[model samples]
Target chain A: MLREDVTEAIRAAVFEELAAVGFARMSIEGIARRAGVGKTAVYRRWKSKLSLVLDLLTAFAVEGLPAPATGSLYGDVRALLEVAAHALRHPVASQVIPDLLVEAARHPEITEAVRATLLDSQRGVVAQVVRDAVERGELARGADADRALDLVVGPLYWRLVVVRDARLPEGYLDDLAHASVAALRA
Target chain B: MLREDVTEAIRAAVFEELAAVGFARMSIEGIARRAGVGKTAVYRRWKSKLSLVLDLLTAFAVEGLPAPATGSLYGDVRALLEVAAHALRHPVASQVIPDLLVEAARHPEITEAVRATLLDSQRGVVAQVVRDAVERGELARGADADRALDLVVGPLYWRLVVVRDARLPEGYLDDLAHASVAALRA
Candidate 1:
């Protein structure tokens, strides 16, 4: 395999391993075997599984989160929710996220990396969206814009990840978006 | 040892094992060893680790949830958030909830038990609170009560469980409760 192909193979295998056995049981040898490469190839790119998973998850999250410039608070929140809903519904994500969350609780390294990269980046995006709304006078200057992000993102996480009952009503995002904006305005 | 003492020891050991190793690595033998009891004592009470965890989790959840009856939407929602916040902050619950959620994704049996016992019961409590508010004319009869429960509970779960960064401000719950009530009113 070419150098890029080898890297890609390792990346794909990392997620496959995570989906198959979870983070605690996952090993470098297992990832290498699934990738059809030597363990040296995996080690050369990343020093450890924590770093490997960290890098890939950061990349996946950044790639998946496309900030919406929908020009309205409701539009932006709804669009973000739609994108989030789609990503959470993916088979790999459905399995891998909760597993990683469980692992992150025990490992402070993973916790900091996830916080700095994934959580902070998403918060930044939400801040930007809220700023735009405030500037447009759609939201008040003293409103809880940061708190609104939690309100918008929280329900999606609650239903998809924790509850898993999937009682997502039709047009759920639409209703959620409407409520979120109304709440922020108040 | 007396039968009650053995049962209590086993119950305590389950949380300890979960805190130490997590659900994926937890075992009946390990729990028995931790509890200082024979395997038979553990097996006699529960058929499998899943059933054992399920029964304990159901009891824990039921005991933790008190169903606030403050007779007002804001009062009830805030009370619920307070109880939930206190429960989520417990060390054992902080460790065990995500582990079970992760395992639940893989095991349909766990999913059903968690949903039936934990999620449904909480939702039921929220429904009762909303029904009281609607009857008292604090909320409209046709308002979205179910969605309000998601808004109320979601942020608490998101911050305490998923984010775990502890950005929870001094008056976070107060602000959230106010916003939740406002959103439902809107």
Candidate 2:
């Protein structure tokens, strides 16, 4: 539908603007201008800036980052985090995504959508990899895949988001992947 | 000094308001009104609302809960997470501290203060306990104390901040603590 395309265009523009200006300073007028649409057109698509930004974030935050199937569970796990860390360093992922995540805590609907779109999807990938590992007798039957996934992803996020480091250092992902796999073995 | 007293009052008032309204809606004027001081008092002390909030957050967030000195490594780990988890569940801790954490990500000064006050403090506790465990041969000397600590704390914070789950169920702390220790040992 033309309307759907217009909505996508406006959301794409909003995501770009959010990357540039952040959540607090992102303006509806600016998004409309960038999308080549009127203010009313933008307003008709989203009820509020929060909803608009939420939709944009949902689309852009988690899409296109699929976990690798590297045959070896360890390789697959490391590849997953390596790709995710690199993606998070992308301009949009780096700059505005954190702002949206922090703000989402305050807005319940946005928080839920981001969780479904961003966290769980990534988590689901990790779970499948772990399931494969379990089937292959690499990981124990009782091993909590989600917890194992957290072991790999959590520290990077802790360092990046909580500790606010510039980037993960060389071999950090590999170290985490190896250690986490060893930790979860039968 | 009279200036110091006023600063303290403004900081305390800001803390109360943050617990009450959160960072998005919190205002210098509201802090002043709550503190029974003029807006100028807050302005004279801090450059921006972020600065003011960060200062207050740094001061108030360094809560040192008790850690049991149980001889067993598992018991000590269990006790530590239990204490941290319960502290997080405390009404004030849940409502007030997360906003500071979110704000800390946006501001460098705040992030450093948080590292010093909250993260480092927790790390110290974990390190001390892990050292005990290593000395007792409960954990292998090669165990990465820091990563093990992160394993325990990360899931709790992820649930609290990301999932926004108010109730941390019974035995959750024990499960995480045991799993973290086991993960490291494995």
Candidate 3:
């Protein structure tokens, strides 16, 4: 309980700092200020902003790529996308992840870590869904699972980061889920 | 030829400025300074940075939306994604469009123009492709054209902005193209 609480407190500080100044401008000092923690304590846990923010992102959004066994491909994908959209809609997750990703383009270590974490986490969700669909005969036998996953989840990322507008409407999610099912089934 | 050359030069300079400093940090004065032109000269042609940058982005990449008449859905989509990839690979086009879109989120005028010029232009392209597909019975008569187009181009935008990677492999393009076809035909 002590470890869990401490981890959450640090993460809360990281999220607050990110929301206030963004990931690029956020610092351990600022996080400490916001969290009311000593700088040494914050550094003792994360060592750097990237490391702290990365863990926060992992804990907040990328923690589990849950694959719901909804008994149908469309339902399962819909569940995944809806949950993803909800999780990403958080002020901290949305602000920090995109900024960190933009920053990652310039910083190789950050880029590698972000890429590895996202791809690994996403791939796991996609593989399970695809495998389930294949076994259920809902997906084509030879359909490429990873590519299908990318197609399924890629649009949500685009709408959030590139479009940077209103949240994904229910219609948008439904369309994505339907199209994903169609693609894999084809 | 003279008019085209001048326009190209102006667009190139605007694009370069965008890449150097993001949309918020970039200004007409900065663009003028970078382009070696008077601010009055820029204002005389385009009303604002939003217009100038949007015009350049549309000119550079919007054409990719108009899919070729490739008889088969596969060929048509393959050609479409290829053109989209080409747009991203173009330095000025790739760097500037994302900056403008992100800027549009906070600016009303830019958002309006993005919807009218950039988004509308590509939507038309996708619509035409879907029409052709429907005519050929490649899609169901009741297939939702707008949703289909979103799915088709969504992955490309996702990889570019969300991934924020410097380079995306041709394999990604291939995978998206194939997956879109599979989805459509399913």
Q: Share of real interface contacts recovered by each model?
A: 0.60, 0.20, 0.38
Q: Quote the positional error of residue B113 for candidate 2 in Å.
A: 1.8
Report, for candidate 3, the interface RMSD: 3.0
Selected candidate, larger lDDT, 2 vs 3: 2
Local accuracy of candidate 2 as per-residue lDDT tens digits, B1-186: 387787777877876777666666778889999988988877877877888766665665576644567998788878887777776676445655555555554555766766676677777788778788889988888666567665667667666654556675566676666666665665
What's the TM for model 1? Answer: 0.92
Ranking by lDDT: 1, 2, 3
DockQ, every prediction: 0.68, 0.31, 0.35
The deviation in Å at residue B22 for candidate 2 is 4.5
Determine which window of 10 residues in candidate 3 chain A has minimal summed lDDT: A92-101
**What's the TM-score of every candidate structure?**
0.92, 0.80, 0.75
User: Which number leads on TM-score?
Assistant: 1
Candidate 2 lDDT over A48-112, as tens digits, reads: 88888667666654664555767888888788877767765665555565555556655667667
Better of 1 and 2 by lDDT: 1
What are the per-residue Cα lDDT tens digits for candidate 1 across B1-186? 899999999999998988888989899999999999999999999999988998887777665355688978899989988887887787655678777777776786777776765576778788888888889998888766568667888878878877784558899989888877877776
Query: Taking candidate 2, what TM-score does its chain B reach relative to the real chain B?
Result: 0.80
Model 2 misplaced regions, further than 4 Å? A1-9, A19-21, A30-41, A61-67, A90-98, A142-145, A183-186, B1-9, B19-25, B41-48, B61-68, B90-106, B140-145
